[model samples]
Target: MSSREAINVISILGSDYSIKAPVGEEQTLLNATRMLNATLADTKRKYPTLIGDKLLVLAALNLCSQQLEMKQRHQEELDRYQEQVNATVDVISRTIGKN
Candidate 1:
């Protein structure tokens, strides 16, 4: 392990995992892991029978769904912004041609 690599122990779904990341990414990893743990904790509340691998899989699916939703929203926003930019550019081009 290099000196710049930070090893952090993050607990999720009652398990302790030592995850390594770049020193600068320590806080970001910690925050993401905490969110994952919280999602698993929510799953545990509704389904007490799920344990071990099943619970982990459920959490993964839930997180993936959330990620996909966010990406779609981001893409939609970007598309809207691009459309406005194109409209403004066209107006500028037309005004310049008239001059």
Candidate 2:
């Protein structure tokens, strides 16, 4: 590993994982582990009998669903902004043509 990279040990669902991250991004890696653990905990709470691989799979699915939802919302927002920009540009073009 280069001097700009560091190894960090992050715990997720009580398991410590050694991960290599860019020097300044160690905290980001830790934060990601924390998010995973939090999700696992929440999944466990909702399904008390879920254990081992099954619980992890459910948590993974939940996270993926959340990601997809966020991406859809983001795309919707971007489309709305693009439509507004297009309208503004058309208005500007019309105003310039009238001059």
- TM of each candidate vs. truth: 0.93, 0.94
lDDT for 57 in candidate 2 is 95
- Model 2 bad stretches (over 4 Å): none
Candidate 2, residues 1-99, lDDT tens digits: the string is 999999998876667788899999988888878788999999999999999889999999999999999999999999999999999999999999999
lDDT for position 69 in model 2? 100
Say which candidate scores most in TM-score.
2
Give the backbone clash total of model 1: 0
Clashing pairs in 1: none
Question: What is the C-alpha local distance difference test score of each model?
Answer: 0.92, 0.92
Angstrom error at residue 1, model 1: 1.0
TM-score for candidate 2, residues paired by index: 0.94
Off by over 4 Å in 1: none
Tens-place lDDT per residue, model 1, 1-99, is: 999998999987667899999989999999999898888889899889999999989988999999999999999999999999999999999999999
